[model samples]
Target chain A: MLDNPYHNKTLQWLAYAAVFLLIGIVPLLTDDDFLLNQLATYGVYGLLAVSISLCWGSGGILNLGQGIAFGLGAYGMAMTMQMQSQAPGTIPPFMANNALETLPIFWEPFWNTGLGIALALLVPTLFYLIFGGLMFVARVSGPFFAIMTLAILSALATVFVALQPYTNGVNGISPPTGLVIAGTKIDPYSSTAYWLVFALLLICTFTAKLLTQSRFGLVVRALKDDPERVRFLGYNVAVYETLVYALSGLMAAAAGASFAVLTQYVSPAQFEVGFSISAVIWAAIGGRGSLLWAMLGAFTVQGAQSYAGDAFLNTWILILGFSFILVVRFLPGGFAGLAELLLGRLASLRGGRREEFGQAPAKGAAK
Target chain B: MANALILGISIASIFLVAAIGLTIIYGTAGVINMAHGEFIMLGAYATYAMQTYFGLPYFLCIPCAFVIVGAIGFVIEKLLIQYLYHRPLDTLLATWGVSLVLIQGTRLTFGSDPKYIQMPGFLSSNIELGGVSLAAFRIFVILAALALIALVWFVFYKTDFGIKVRAVTQNREMAAAFGINSKQVYSFTFAFGAGLAGVAGALFGVLNIVLPTMGTGYVVQAFLIVVTGGGALMGSAIASIATGEMQSIFAMLLNDSFARFLIFILIVVFLRFRPQGLISAGGSRR
Candidate 1:
């Protein structure tokens, strides 16, 4: 079934490694803090896109409220960094500015850096597990699952905006000074921060890619194709889906935590439905079935937006919306699909007999 | 206390109008349109354009908005949605893309500032009964909601088009086999739904600021009603009334934000126990 050019094992791994090599060597080429920070943001977004691809594309779990978990991670680290920035015996600056006398109980645990980071990952994981377990066990799939997550994200954004004293309201809370943990500080606009984000993105991409190549990954692909068939084969469909869903939460939170450290802010706007939907767009543009391409999709779109923000301003999003429609309608495989077509042509041109799987249809390229 | 119930019913009516468009499209065409909100937004924008340019009365703008937005919807379905009748997920993504285009397009045209539609002098006043007090416009909105529900009922049940729509919704191939042009039914149904949303936008423009992004706020609530109602007209009405009342009462006890949060959680939990919703569409995909 894995006879297609997109799933060519050796070539994919090599391409993935080459991209990481290029990413890792960027710092050596430039001392521009602005550029590094921008790239670091891409790496964080890359992690997020990969997670979305893992669950939404591969596992067939359409989670539209992923930004909530992303926000949870951002807030988790921000709470710690916010506490760190305060004077001894005083509340965080945001809370102090809002006239809060004591820290909220939830914010108390985040004062310690370790607990803050741990909770950043742990809390979102638990949330995904419980939420996914509930939905999947009940056999809810497809559009209903997608819409529910969208609703939850929008509801959470409203709640976050309302919790002005705690969430710092619409303007958001920023710990711009960066984070210090165990005597080592991760500066917001430094090579160290960039390297950290870059390294994590690579690790996450590699691990997730490997996971997708495992036996478990095969089941997920099968499940995505036909959940009933997977279930009939004696596989616990809900457990498998819920597990991957929780893993996606972990990855997203990690990215969010890094985002907090790199950007030094967490806002109610980050929890907005648009934020999560854009992540979906990135995954879709990159080809959701391929992790590397999905991350690259984030890099490409976000990079374009960042560069085009000033000149185009209003027209950028209008054009982007149009592009998204075209991609959805015509280019379902996205950049990955384009790459696959080229590879297939190259193979055919060589007058070589391509490995043909007897039972696999051409549509099952990723299988 | 009783005042809250009155307010709740009023809010429920508004939600029902906003969601009816979405429910109709989903029911008749089996589409999950993410651009449903944008269609409603276009409706409000159409109303605003009429008032600002022609100095059209608030009451008269409703039908104008309906026709303008519904025509746009009809054209959109013919051009884009017709190709995606079988793919719900693709339809959603495509509609979302359409929504983005519409939002940005409107923003480009109107700018981001809030616009206002002048209501009649009587609607600007308030109606008071015993201890309860509410805006005359709010009361007007409530009546308008009821009118929309009744109008929709009449269309869906009493007309030949309704039979065609229902036939296609139940079984598309069979409907097609029975000399019913399912495609035409879908386009008309989509246009009708869009018209309803346009009316919703015209009403909502008076209640809130008429901004490009206003549809977003209503859209979530609309989806909540639809999901809770199980994607059927009767179910959507019952769900809207129940959720609206519950939200209002909860807000009375706590706060609006918390009340909304509670409703969201309650819906999620409610769906867990009954994924079919407050009213299931039997074994059909709602």
Candidate 2:
């Protein structure tokens, strides 16, 4: 019997490698720009899922406002890219739309692409780290953390929209042209954007998997299960928590930047409550416990959305809403857990094991 | 400045009414009902239905919304929330699912267009006192909030049913052993909370636009108040007033949205320093 197939790292890596190989070769086989764009967006979404898995799944810090970081990243990338196309003296498009004559002081820094990218990732990471640090150091655990993040989510949703001149309000902001790197211009629909996002997605998942497998990851898991006990064991749980939260924010911001490049648009829409909640849903569905599965979970949901198209968006939400409930309530371990269970079943069947009644080992099914 | 204080109190009352239901459910049952906002939305929709379809007046629609949304809450408790007790994280996610379903369902039923509730002509007018002038509807809302809080306080302290609820709140296992049906208490408490949110929605519908998504905005405020208050009636009462005054004062000092951002930042700092809140819901196992 496969007593615990989930912890079998070899099987996980094999699956991951196969998926990565498939993503790599698909572009070579396909000529459709739309397909390439969609896949690129999915790759960015994979980063979002990986972030959630790291924080909520692995670190036990159910950050409901991860999308805030994602939006910040998108703004960072889009603003920097937008500057590449505009005149040096001119204001940002959104600021100009509001009839502001002078470019905002903040926008000036983003004109330098390297500084913008670094700031985009670092700022959100710092924000999330500080926020998580405050909450955890004060011993705010579980639902309180969730509630506070949720409050941040709703607040950011409004705050982003309220900052219309900067965010361009509901209409959203897109760069007038593709980002020019050296002599190469990267169009969102091109194979280059697809490969870039796909590479980042891989790097993010690998880094997360490494972290989760290391001693830091061990403490993170312990922190999730019983934080007080972890603290009692003389571990600085708050530092561990803050680090993971910052890491999650960094990953989310990277994905958001990828989104700005891959989709060529950024807006308050990314800061909406729906976007934040969807991150949780993806992690939940994909198997928050497994970093790879969580990324796939994002891919699965985003793929479904593309298939369904924008017309039935509400219908998609309705379906995901029900799935979210059922998964959380009945299938807490989600798809990865289910896969492990099925594998265990198959192993038992193949092994012809005759375990005594009441002797079946608990598989840690729903932690 | 006095006018702003009154307005702050008015906003405070609105927050209290909005949060009372959430406090009751979380305090007693320990379920952080994320769907609490959806119930608020349902309440508004119920009031709209009664007024538009049944041709009922706004005054009568309040009770109708209470009953209607409360019944829905009861059904939801029986079907889903019952399975989720003691599992706080699961309950949070499940209730969030419920909120999503409720929001999309409402949007599907009501369409995306904004709906309006017709209040009486008197409520449409403004009341003048000294140098202050405020909407009569605001005064009505304040009175409604006070009346609701008083009634909830009375229910929790004055009745036999209230004792059962308090017992359950203190210790569900002990309450069960003492022959108090804790499940029944939970069901009733959840229903009452939902009904309170219904009342909040009915009032807020007039105060803001009646959209399918209106509850999203209020839910954040409601949550902040509930947490700051430490999930007790008096805690919520004091917390709401404090939050409202801070918000009003910040708004007066800065721009409106800037004030909101500052309030959020302040709330986080406040919670970081005092996660147990201004007043803890004491003598109970969290």
Candidate 3:
């Protein structure tokens, strides 16, 4: 089942290492803080794309609430930084404006950076565990599961906006500057920040890839193929799915936290249904079943979006929508599949066995 | 209490129109169109274009919107949905792309500015019953919804095409074996569904601001109704009415945002217990 050329274990790890090195050195290669920030943004997006792939591609659960996970991270960190940006003892200005004499109980814990990060990961994971667990145990899958996640995203976005005092309304929570952890101040556009994001991206990618290639991933993929058969084989399918979903939420939260630091803001827009759907598109176009390809696809598509924003005033969305359709319809393997085909052709010309490397024995390739 | 009940029925009427199209498309083709909302958006745009450029009356815009959107749906079904019928997920993704194209394309042409359709003077006024006052437009919406539902019921139950559609929906290969052109039925059914969305859009344009993103707002509710309804006409009708009434009652008791949040939560929990929806069709692919 792992015979796909893109699933070549050594080649994948090498690709992972190579991509990490390339992105890690990008800050050093460029002195422009703007470019560095953009790279950091892409890295954060890469983390998000990898999260989507981990759950949807390998675990057979299409989580469209990924933006909520990402936004929870951003909101968590933003709340911390927003408090930190003010004087030590004063309530957040927004809370004061809302006529509160003191910080809300929820906001009190986020004042600590460590608590912020922990909450970022814990909140989203717990959300996924409850939500995904309920759906999975109820035996919801396929289109029904997909739409339910979308509902979560829309509902979350709305709830964020409606909870004005805590969420700062639709204007969102924006700290004037980057976060301070212990005695270290994080400057968002600085090389250090870029490296931090790059490091997080690397950690997320490697861990996700490792998970998807592991025995647990194999069972998840098998379960995705036929849940009843896996159940017949004595596996608790819902538990495995819930675990992977929660793990994906953890990764998304981490990305979202770092993303807030990079952007210096957290808006309800971050939790928009469109934003979550974009993550799905990135995974789909990257190679839904492959973590490495999905990460690359995020970078590639986001890079194109950034570049296209400058070149085409409004046609970029049209082009993106069209490409998304074309990819789903004609190029189901996405850019990763195209790369695999090219590599396979090259290997075949050099007298290698094409079938073993080029074509996966089954559609579930990563496992 | 009567006022709230009346308000709920009015809200339910609009949702019923929006959800009916979705139910038909999903019930017939088993395609969960992500672009369903976009089609409704296009219908509003069509109405706006007709009223502004062609000087078509607001009442006349309904059929015009329906025909134009239905034609677009026909073209889409022929060009794209036809190929994706075998893959439900692909249909979801591809239709999402279609929605993006529709939304962006509309934005490019019409810009992001909100547009409105001028309702007739009567619809613009209010009627008093006892001590309660209701907008004439809301009553019109309710009557229009009832008319459309009746039309759909008549079409589906009292026509040969309806039988063909039901047959094809139940078993495509068997229907084909019985000399029914399932493909044609699918195309017609898709077009009909799109037409219903167009009418919904036309009505919504008056009820709310008509913008490129308006469809999304309605589409979410439509989805809730359709999903809860289990993709059937009767189911959608009942679900929409129940949801609308509950939303109104919730809003009356709590604030609007909290009410909506509660509804969304309830729907999710409801789905947990009844994933097949309020009613499940037998022989459905489990």
Candidate 4:
């Protein structure tokens, strides 16, 4: 039975590959720009879901501050878009409005997309590197980890709210005019933008899968199971944990950049504690060990909420919360394990009936 | 100066009541009870419903709100929290879900608008001392919170029931072997803690807008208080009042958000130095 576990895993990979190809070709089958826009949004969420899975599922890090990393990414990308859209040789609108005679020194570097993208990865990774390093080194695990991260998020939110000159103070930043990709002007609502988002999602998903299959992945899982044992094995568990955390932050930031491009706006609301909590629910519902399950869980929950409409939107949180409880209670192995269990049961039932009836001349012959 | 002091005391009183209940549960059960804020919301709404719908006098509705909200807490403990006694992480998530349900239910029923519970004629009156006027309700809140604290102290340190509760909190298995019904103690303790939160909520609603999302704001503050206070009932009360007074004074001097940020930074720094907390030395870290 264990020998064929890889067989099921291969089948699962194929199924996910098929879904990815279908989504990639969606714009080709439809002329509806609105549909493509919605799919792009889903792709952004998928990136986030995968990022969350990499950390929480594989790294045993319950980061309730995924939104903070995302906000960093969104703010980074949005700042560049804002700077690029200003009149040639003129300051951005906010600085212009604030009576600043010259462009701020900080805003100067973001004019280059390369710098902005680099910062998007660096900022969140650095934030996590410092914070996660401190906590893990201090031996803060479990609920304390959750609370400390939440405290960091609260601080970030307050900073965002207070720094009106930079963050616009709760109003958040919107992408300025058109998105410039490698000097090519692209409408945020265009199919090209959607395709770009899809490509990024593929890259993130593939990278996450690769990370999970590597030797580092084995060490991380071992740390999760027995931290003392890993320490005894002469591995620097804190460094490994921090590295995985920074990687997760980078992935989250990448997703946030895509989200900013797709939505054309970014706000404090996007990084609220609710968003972070929902990510936890997604990770839990998708099953913690499987990347495919995490993505499927995100798609299922988000798709359900979208289909349920605006009237039910407010109640979507309650639904998600209850779903977390249900998943924890009834499906401890989550949707992925549950699917495998059902399939196995059906196969066993068929074999048993076949033995009872002496195969019954093989119902439905190949010929 | 007198008015500011009075306002500070009133705010501190609210925190004291909320943080005490939170500390009790955290200290004894090692459960953070994130839904404690929701219980406060329930209490506030219960009082609002009583006064507005039942036409009860505001004074009469206070105890009634406590009973109604306390019953809700009891039911929640018996039905949901009991199953999660051995599972802290699951308990946290489940209670979070319960809090969402409560908030959404309130939004659905109350239409998301802030509801006002009119202060009684006595509480609406103000007392003047040396040209400084203080709201009578503020005085009442301070006194009531103090009385509640005194009562809790007596129960916890001066009674057999309190001893059993504390014993179970210290070690459930050992206490059970010693003929203590840990299950019963857990239910009663959770219900009692939740009841205190409810009363805090009802009383606090008078000082602020009673809204569906009001609990969300208090939840973090309560956690900060519980952590800072040392995860014990006395420590939480003292820390909460101190923090509350500090915050109010800071807010009076600086921007409210800035004051909050400073306090949070202080707490984080304090945790770095003494992670076991201010009240409970060697307590299990939640």
lDDT of 2 by residue, A78-182 (tens): 888888888878777668769888877888888888888888788888888888888889988888898888778667766777778877877777898887777
Tell me the TM-score of chain B in each candidate. 0.97, 0.97, 0.96, 0.92
Cα error, residue A249 of model 3, in Å, equals: 0.9
The sequence of per-residue lDDT tens digits that candidate 1 reaches over residues B140-221 is: 9888878888898898889998888888888888889999998899999999988888988888888888888887777677
Q: What is the lDDT of residue B132 in candidate 3?
A: 62
- Candidate 1 vs candidate 4: the lDDT winner is 1
**Clash-forming residue pairs, model 4:** B229-B279, B230-B278, B230-B279, B230-B280
Query: Which residue window of length 10 is worst by lDDT in model 2 chain B?
Result: B277-286
> What TM-score does each of the candidates earn?
0.96, 0.96, 0.95, 0.91
Docking class of 1: medium
Clashing residue pairs for model 1:
none
* Model 2 CA lDDT for position A32: 94
lDDT of 2 by residue, B61-136 (tens): 9999899989899999998999999788889889999998999999999998999999999899988865779899
Native contact recovery (fnat) for each candidate is 0.72, 0.79, 0.68, 0.35
Q: Where is model 4 chain B poorest over a 10-residue stretch in terms of lDDT? A: B277-286
Chain B TM-score of model 2, please?
0.97
Q: Could you tell me the C-alpha RMSD of candidate 3 in Å?
A: 2.9
Q: Write the per-residue lDDT of candidate 1 for residues A203-271, one digit (tens) a residue.
A: 888999899999999999899888999999999999999999899989999999899898888898878
Interface RMSD of each: 1.1, 1.6, 0.9, 1.9
